[model samples]
Target chain A: MVELLAQTGLNAVYAASYISLVAVGLVLIFGVMGVVNFAHGELFMAGAYAVVALYADMHVPFFVAVAIGMAFVGLLGLLMEWALFRPLKDNPLGGLVASIGFLMILQSLAVMGFGVRMEHIPPVTQEVVRFTDKVGLPVARLYVIVAAVVFLSALWYFLKRTRFGWALRASAQDPEAAALQGISITQTARIAMFIGAALAGVAGALTAPLVSVNPHMGHSVIVTAFIVIIVGGVGSLEGAILASIAYAFVHTFVTTFWDGVLADIVGLSLMLIVLIVKPTGLFGSADRA
Target chain B: MRNFLILLVGLAALIALPHGLSFSQQEILVFLVINVLLVTSYRLLTLTGEWSLGHVVIMGVGAYSSALYTKELGVYVPVSMLLGAVTAALLAVLLSFPLFRMKGFYFLIGSFAAGEIIRLIWKRFREPFGGVRGISGIDPMPDFSVGFYQFDFFEPVSYYYFAGAIVIACLWILWRIEKSPVGLTFHAVHWQDKLAQASGVNLRAYRTLAFAIASGFAGLAGALQGHYVGTVNPNSFDIEVMVFVLTWAIVGGTATFYGPILGCIVLTVLNEIVLREMGLEQARPLIYGAIMILSILFLPNGLESLVQKATRRKTTAKPEEKAAT
Candidate 1:
């Protein structure tokens, strides 16, 4: 029982790692843009396809492909900022509807390019680290866990210790005040969008080999991200990370013990409970959410 | 008198419409009528300044309830459908307890989570909902002869007439609700809730009322869908359908009553007829997405703006715009 519990803890850690990556990016974009990006999951899918093309197809190094995936998806975010979010900045609803439109465009593009079927990515590594006969972590999965920690820590340092990070947060807090303080609102929004998009992309790229890569795969990822962000608090970064960890444990454990559908139900129920009890979330200030 | 004449002419045209269309086109018309109900009901919910991502799921709630009521409890299909709608409205009331705590983006996401839970419930239970495949072999609306036409369930035109009449009735009721003092209060709740509250408007109650009413109509639409299609699956009412409803509401512009209905008709024609004829089925979503993005950028006010521009009758357009947001 102890070994099983440890194994589940490790699984939850891995789950929390990638989930926080996606949730944090979602929080960042919402913080800066004040628009709910319905197309974010597609951006993650775009990252996975980046891996499929560069790493799996072109035979580039795995880490390099992951980097390209991150940058490429970030560029896509820049495109969205220029085209959709910028013009609809004042109209949050318009921005949201436009993102839904963009989601369709991305999904259809994927269907057209790769077909609707799942693309099997070759295993990047077959090695596993074992603590017991029945308890083991695959090296590929470990890569996702490690990358999430490194990228998230770097993001933490960037936000807290860097000048632009402060500017980003300032803009997120109050756009007009930030603008008066000599921060460019447009530039901050672009940077936030790019970084946000890159994080989701990198998470998708790292986990591509472990899951089925397909056009519709983003649907579940986006759902999970929404659950995490809502439970975490919409604009609070730390809340998102903590909520991601909490949700990962509950969801992974429930799925392990019961069923997948029930696990989804439980996760969504938890989000609803949070919204009812504390609409702002566990770590969120009431004003932000 | 002039308005009455226009109504008569419109009714005649609608009654005559299916005769000119092919069988498939007639079927599309039936679905379109049902969708007209869905989108218009969605507008009613938006009237309170909240857009719900789970409206489609609420529609599914009605579908499953009505389907099961008829299938399991041996209720009349029509009565069960009404009960289904009532069930949906009640469910909305229940959900509003938890959901109305959050406003704006939080409300949107909260509604989504509530909807997802409901959908997962349908997916998890196999006894009645039939799991992922959903409830199939649903009971159809029994055929009856109208004096002007012998209604046939097998033929799509007959169902079109039946659904058309029901939809017209629902729209009439919705129009009355919008025009009434209650509608003004809904608008008040939307535009300046705090001030309205100062003036004794129960903001929460009004919001919940609008949500319940909207869910009821959406449920009715779902029942219409189930009876016509003879199947009710979880996949049938997914986010894609909700996105379509949102697209119609946004692209057609929500400022006017006719906006979303107009959007529903035009987009349906474009998606079903124009794209289908061009033989670009696979590229349909791509083209549709492009249209959505382009229109949002250029026609932020929606197709209703164009209608207003062409008619040159500026009546209430400006005031309505303020109330719209």
Candidate 2:
């Protein structure tokens, strides 16, 4: 029982890693750009497809493929900002609607580019690290977990230790005030959009081999990301991380013990309960609610 | 008198509209009519200054419940649909307890979570809810003979007319509600909740009222679709459908009652007739997406704004003559 529990715990940790990566990116975009990019999940999908194209189909090195994927998705994010969000900046709802439009376009393009069938990328590695006779962690999953930690730490350091980070934070907190201080809102928005989208891309690229990559695969993970961000607070990065971990544990345990659908219900119900009990999320201060 | 004449002509045109279409087009017409009701109900909810992502799921509540009433208990189809709508309204009231606690973006996310939970429940349960496959072989509306026309359940044109009549009646009721003092209160709550509260308006109650009423109508729409399609599935009421509703409302401009209806019709005509005629079914979503983005970017006020503008010009130009007439 203990071994089984440990295995589940490890699995939950892995889930937490990717979930936090996605949620943090969502939070950052919402915070900095003041728009919910509904196309975000599509950016992640685009990243995964990038890997499928470059590594699986074209024989590129795995890490090189992931890097290109991340860059490509970040570029997509930049395109969205320039084409949609920037023009609709004054109207947040308009921005959201436009992002939804972008999402459909991306999905349709995916369907056109690579048919609707799920693509199973060949496994990157075949090794698993065994902690015990009954517990092991696959190397692919470990790559995701390690990459999440490294990227998140780097992001944390950037936000705290860099001038661009300070400018981004200032703009997120008070765009007008930041503007008064000569911090260009457009520059910060571009930076935030790029980084936010790249994080989702990397997460998707890293997990491409682990999950079935499909045009509609974004739907489920986007729901999971929404749950995490809402539970963590809309604009709080640390809150997003914590909420992702908590949600991952709960969802993993529920799925392990019961079923995936039930796990989804439980996760969503938990989010609803949090919204009812604390409308600003567990750690959110309602800065931009 | 002029307004009445216009309305009569519009009604006549709608009645004549489906006859010129092919069989598949007539089928699209039925779903289009049903969607008109759905989008309009969604507009009613937005009037109270709250936009719910759960509106479609609530519609599903009506569909599932109505289907169950007919399938499991053998209730009359028409009566079961009403009961299904009532059930949805009651469910909205219950959900409002937790949902209305948040406002704006929080409310949006909360509604989405609440909706996902409902859909997941339907997917998880197999006994009554029919699990992932959903309830199939639903009871269709019974055939009947009117004085002038024989109604059959099998023909898309028949179903279109049937659904069209119900939708028109629902739209009329919705219009009446929107024009009433309660509707004024709803607008008041949306535009200035603090002021409305100071003016002795119960904000929560009004929000809940709009939500319940809108959800009830949405349920009716769902029930109408279920009977026509002869099936009810969880996937049918998913977020993708919700996005379509949002797109219609947003692209139509929600300031006027006719706006979303106009948007829904125009977009449906474009998507169904033009896209299909061109043999670009695969590129349909792509073009639709491009249109959505273009409209938001360039025509942020929506297609209705153009109509409003044209009317404003006509009214301004012919004020004296119009008044004299």
Give the poorly placed runs of model 1, Cα more than 4 Å off: B313-325
lDDT of 1 at B67: 95
- Calculate each model's fnat, 2 decimals: 0.84, 0.86
> DockQ of all candidates, in order?
0.80, 0.84
lDDT per residue for candidate 2 within B218-274, as digits (tens), equals 999999999988899999999998988888887888888998998899999999999
Tens digit of per-residue lDDT, candidate 1, span B143-224 = 8887878988999998998999999999999999999999999999999898999999999999999999999999999999
DockQ of 1: 0.80
Best by lDDT: 2
> A58-138, model 2: which lDDT tens digit per residue?
989999999999999999989988998888889868888898899999999999999999997999999999999999999
- Residue A270 in model 1: lDDT: 91
Error of 2 at A145 (Å): 0.9
Candidate 1, A90-160: lDDT as tens digits: 87678888898999999999999999999988999999999999899999989999998999999999999
